[model samples]
Target chain A: MSVTAAFPSRARAWLRGLLAGPLALLTALLTMMGGALWLPEGAAGLDHLVVPVVFFPMLWAGWFLYACLDPRLLRGFAVVGGAALLQLGLILVHLMAAKGAVT
Target chain B: MIKLPKQQTQSLLAVHGWSGVLLGLLLYAVICTGVAAVFAKEISDWSSPLSRPSGQELPTGFDAAYRDLARQVDPLFLHEVFLFPTAGGRWNVLFHVDEKDAKGQPVERGTEFELDPKTLKPLARRDGLLDEIADQRRSNAVADFLVDLHVRLHLPNPWGLLLTGTLGLMMMVAAVSGLFLHRHLFKEIFTLRRRGGLLTARDVHVVAGAWNLPFAFLLAFTGSFFSFATTIGVPAMAMVAFNGDIEAATAALTAKKLPEDPSPVTPANLDALFADARQRGGARVGFVSLEHWGRADARATVQLEAREGGLLNTAYLYSLASGEFIREQPFLGHVPSTGNSLVLLMSPLHFGNFAGVVSKSVWFALGFAGAYVTLTGMLLWTRRRQEQRSWRIMDRAVHLVGYGLPLALAVAPYAYFLLRDRGPHPADTQGVLFLAVAATLIVCAAVADDLTRYRRRLLAATGVALAGLPLARLASGGIGWSAAWQQGLASLLAVELALFVAGALYLRLALRRSATDEATPAAGPAMQA
Candidate 1:
């Protein structure tokens, strides 16, 4: 029993990972685009198209992604977050200084 | 009790995982952005000094500013311009525009211009106020981008709102599914092992998620309303009860609209009405609309409504000719109305903009925490994996977004002080801040390794930067301690205290990194990076 518990369970873990984050993002974006395209035009131009096109699919996709996270992606999220921060801070000083009064 | 097969359980768990995973990121963005948005006005106020473009002209007085529009703007656009005033803050001029026909739907356009404080000449800039700041920081664009990212990610309007609503639904799904997946929701609420593998990620996800359930739920429900009503709420209501007459349905939801008579004569007494508006509505009489601005046939109308935290979202219309209140549009005031009232309520609750400093501060802190929750979620997710393709890129992005936001936020006020004091002509305060913040985010995004260390560095910097902020105010001719001391320093103290607290929180999080690193040795090494 203990040996069974110790086994990689990589399938479960990987499948679990797929259900979260970027996977959801992809699904939602697709859903929104697809749904928007499907819904009858509200008036014309993009704004009308936007609501149905982007939102529903995204919403549905989120659920789907949660249902699927691709766990590998989860592992990298924070590390990438840290890198993004460093870049953000450096640019902020420049932006803050360039803009004059920052209030 | 019948136990489902393990595979079925895993599938259900997968259902929860996927839906919940995206939620943590999106919700974090929304929460953080929403939090930052709460202090937007205050940040702008703080940063306005830097916004002083190169000019020496005193801010345009309300009367002159009002008269300028009276003379300059076409009569059609002249209901009245709501000047935000330039007392170390961005100037916003808003008036309702006549869209379509007279009996047609009236559209309100909030045209924000960064004015030369010296000349009172309008500055051509977009993204008005906070958005302007975002634009400059280029980081602001990221924020706007994040906002877009958060709510529909710039998918267009109602659909975007609907998308966010669906996201909100997913948030709800994640919340619910999360509960089901976690056998120990309450037990693990505050459990942060900072350990390795799935356990670490699990702790971060459950803890933050559990703690912020209220905020999370509110975010989803209110956010969804933006698109949800048009897509779901309104339609659902119509289908069930109103027979699909959305307009009629909306009218019934709020109070009925009185079709005022078309008086052609422009009003003579805007001053009296404005004074009365202040008296009746208290200080925050935000809305001023002209029933009709142009043509001898048009009557000048001024509509004054309450801002958030005040008594009413209701407005009263005064015909400039008849200065007396024509009639008041009564709002439920904190009470929810099915139609417009619901719309009115959404901004305050979602943005947490409805309260005084204390409430806003509470919201701001929560928002910051929410940002952390997202950062941790991503970190925990990624930490579980030893290696992968594009891991570094994704890791960098998270750091950029997470640390970028606060770094930009802290830098704004500092930038404001330096810039405000510079060049004779005050620069555009909002614009300057945005530019600085953006530049900072990009550079930080490019260089940072372990986002936590970056966060710590930024937090320490922010705390030091803020410590000097109050002193700078003293050195400059801003409201000093003597002046503030008399007024109880309520406003000043409130803002500073909030900033200080925010700095402290960041510092604390940074301090805790070591403990967390012990759990995940890879994380410890990454922290140095």
Candidate 2:
């Protein structure tokens, strides 16, 4: 195979690797953070905090497996990247709103 | 059971093999130590017990002991006090106040006293930080040594937790991928072949791995949760929710706030509260915490062992000033909820202390099998590639660690027993001896040409060390079997017998293997390696 033909396949593999490794980790953590925001605070006022921690392993595994087994590399990147961005946006917005209220 | 395309299956196989090969030794170490750690309480009792068996965890005069100790401590430390039984039922009472250290770090500083269970008199006293108190403890050295290694590998916090957490994830990857890699999972569960060489080794690994899949997943999942909960989960949650105040986050999740009443009042008798908690919870009191001592808002939380035929422990709250029952406390929340229930399940599911000795025995056997699967998996991986020099050396290393770790663990307690009084602190001695044994094994692995002989020698040494432990204990003032039986010290007798039986079995296996291998020089794949 020519070098030009190999470059695209190599780039695709690297992107997939990035998605499966760091991006998957980022998504899992953000989901855990976002869970506390959206989930209900139960009678003890700690459900949101405790539930996400208990299921943290499963959350990470689900994201990691999806990143590895997805056939469409582009689709894999889109989903993981999308989840991370969404959670980050949610957290940032919540922080900004709290800061505004404090001011 | 689960079908996938050929390419995906190949990917799964690659993942499984790589994960196991990369972290299998550390994972094996953790699992092996954990098998022993399942009996940590019993081992502590066996290694360092009082002359007679303990009467009750919380005896009648516990109130007098508390009051006498409280008089010696600073009044500020009366903000919180923790009372529990440890180190063969020696009563430990800590009067502490949560405050910032000189370095501006949050810490609990306190005066701690260890009291004799029978006489209710102080055996030892220390005034300092809680962490320092823990580090200075010598009575439970052997059990603490083994439990610490399993929990954190004895490295510093956060980093040790991170490494073990990552290992837990690697274990989960191997377990999950193994599920996909085996096409005939149910068949393989009963398919151990008696044929010789690499094929037979492969069959044994598969059968053991197949039967232990669910257990491995459960252990790995729960183990990872524990390792990561404080390291990653707590920090991340605190950052978002409490503006990076980990202390505040922890307080919110754990403590139930009561309205402040600063008026001083005479504190109620702790013995009455203990008896009430035991009766109401239908279990023995295991631990007690007093908050705001001698004040109207004072409260006590008494954590009890699991009730009869139950899986989770129950803690009851009480008004310390009034001596009235407040409520049964949930693990995480003020009221029982889904989150609290899930958090409660984690301990019994991970430690297997829910149903007492029977449950612990089951967990120990399954954990032992998990360790076996990991060791065999590594051996088979390296054995297949022994043509390469690196892989051949790896085969030696696998044998070295796989067999050497148990040998080192077995030998560590001898230092604990011998050095408990005359020499250095037994905790430090245990660590030094453990490293010495490991280093010696490493040297042997490096110099020895015959891998099989090295393994057998390690096994024999382990057996001898184990069998001789009871003698060391006896020499260091441990009770003998007849006295133990008469005094109803079943834990001591049981542990002694178990160690002897296990040691004899190991010696028998080693002798039998030496004989069989001498007869046929190149009979098995392990010998070939």
DockQ (C-alpha based) per candidate is: 0.03, 0.71
Task: For model 2, name the residue pairs that clash.
Answer: none
Which window of ten consecutive residues has the lowest lDDT sum in model 2 chain B? Answer: B519-528
Query: Of the candidates shown, which would achieve the greatest DockQ relative to the real structure?
Result: 2
lDDT of 2 by residue, B1-529 (tens): 7899987887788778878998888999999998999999999888888877895478897898789889999999999999888877898988999899789988999999998898899989988889898877888899999999998999999888888887888888889989988989998888866544324667878888999999898888899899999999989999888878898898888878678999999999999999999888889888888999999999999999998789888999999999999998887767888888887888888889988899999999999999989988998788777788788778888888998999999999989887778767788899999999899899989887788778778888889989999999988788888888999998888999999999998888678874534332222344333
lDDT of 2 at B141: 90
Residue B250 lDDT, candidate 1, scale 0-100: 50
Q: What TM-scores do the predictions have?
A: 0.60, 0.95
lDDT of 1 by residue, B383-434 (tens): 5443663555555555566556556545544444554445521224534674
Off by over 4 Å in 2: A1-14, B196-199, B514-529
Quantify all predictions' global Cα lDDT against the true fold: 0.51, 0.86
